[model samples]
Target: SIKEKPSSKAEKEDENPGTVRILLLGAAESGKTTLLSQIRMLYKQTFTESELIHRRAYVYNHIVSSMKAILAFASANDLQLSLDNQQRAKEILSIEECLGPFTQQEYDAIENLWKDPAVQEAYKKRGNFNLNDSAK
Candidate 1:
């Protein structure tokens, strides 16, 4: 016999005409954004141009943060990057949130760090810690 899942608040809301509330909670990189995107698609929602622009900046910032996490993991585990890649890792760690999108230099730094063998090894072990999906 198959088990029936209990109905939750969302199902209860369908009986009346009112706002629906949902909360997503999970560890980092656990697909919260993916779930939200699915929900939006289910509702036939679309992002406005301004929202798209803001989301672009978000993607840039997430890339930087993901690199920082990988670099930190490499350092903590005593993995050594090449001198130039070490410099790139330092630059990525010190980067602030992107207001718009990443500049060319910033983007290159992340790409270089990501190509480092140390970073790649760290990425392989990312499941031991919280690293963003963008790092993949």
Candidate 2:
């Protein structure tokens, strides 16, 4: 059996008056925008049926614009947050409110995806130390 959140839908919302921030650290082009948009669509809800659909669409656009980066946590990578997980979703948004926006690359790096060889190699190259002490 699945567990449920204690708060009602109206109890928590994007405009509830709190700040949230997410630190997305990634190399580059890791589909950060897509992930965020997907998250926004996932938690979206409205009491009425029409509101549900419209609100969901509205949520999608808002997320895309803001490009919510809270969904990139390594833990959340495997498990998606659906409408049933509204509580977590709200928390993420609330956090992002304070943290501000971050790019997909930001997410990947923050999530430690930079461990990849390519990223490591590139980083090494960028930060290479040409120690020519002996020649002196």
Candidate 3:
């Protein structure tokens, strides 16, 4: 673990200061968040339950959004879903953004859609569109 150094005004006046600052820059899923989480752990900065809950909600929301994007791409590219999964895709797209965390049925629908060949094809070209890191 890296420890923070305590410095006085006199230290600030010194040729070399004790304080160090780091700047992180990256695109999505490029490990920026992972690095920050590791740094927070090293500094004993634990996330609360409420924060974890919010992260869970974020994951759920990401699933919904990713599915929607994949479905739209499939439609635009003439990728056809199976008869069963076509209905599932429609249900996924119809989901309201603020409907909250997914229910079991909704989760099942998402899982099934994810397994669809048409959705998988669109997912392969996910880089062409803007999707969440969690979507991967």
The most accurate candidate by TM-score is 1
- Each candidate's root-mean-square deviation in Å? 8.7, 21.4, 7.2
Error of 3 at 68 (Å): 1.0
Cα lDDT of model 1 by residue, 1-136, tens digit: 9965549976666656776777899977688878988898899999789978887877777777778788878889999999998777777787877667677888788778778889889999999878865667
Displacement of residue 77 (Cα, Å) in model 2 is 38
TM-score of 1: 0.73
Report lDDT per candidate: 0.81, 0.41, 0.80
Q: What's the CA RMSD of model 1 in angstroms? A: 8.7
Two-way TM-score contest, 2 vs 3, winner: 3
State how far residue 94 of model 3 sits from its true place (Å): 1.6
Candidate 2 regions exceeding 4 Å error are 1-19, 45-136
Model 3: per-residue Cα lDDT over 25-133, one tens digit each: 9976688767987998998989999878876776777778888888888899899999999888888888777336777888888888888898888899888777665
- By summed lDDT, the worst window of 10 consecutive residues in model 2 runs over 127-136
Off by over 4 Å in 3: 1-34, 98-100
Relative to the true structure, candidate 3 has a C-alpha RMSD (angstroms) of: 7.2
Clashes of 2: 19
- Can you tell me which runs of candidate 1 are displaced by over 4 Å? 1-30
All candidates' TM-scores?
0.73, 0.20, 0.69
Q: Over all chains combined, what TM-score does candidate 3 have?
A: 0.69
Range of the 10 consecutive residues with the lowest summed lDDT in candidate 3: 10-19
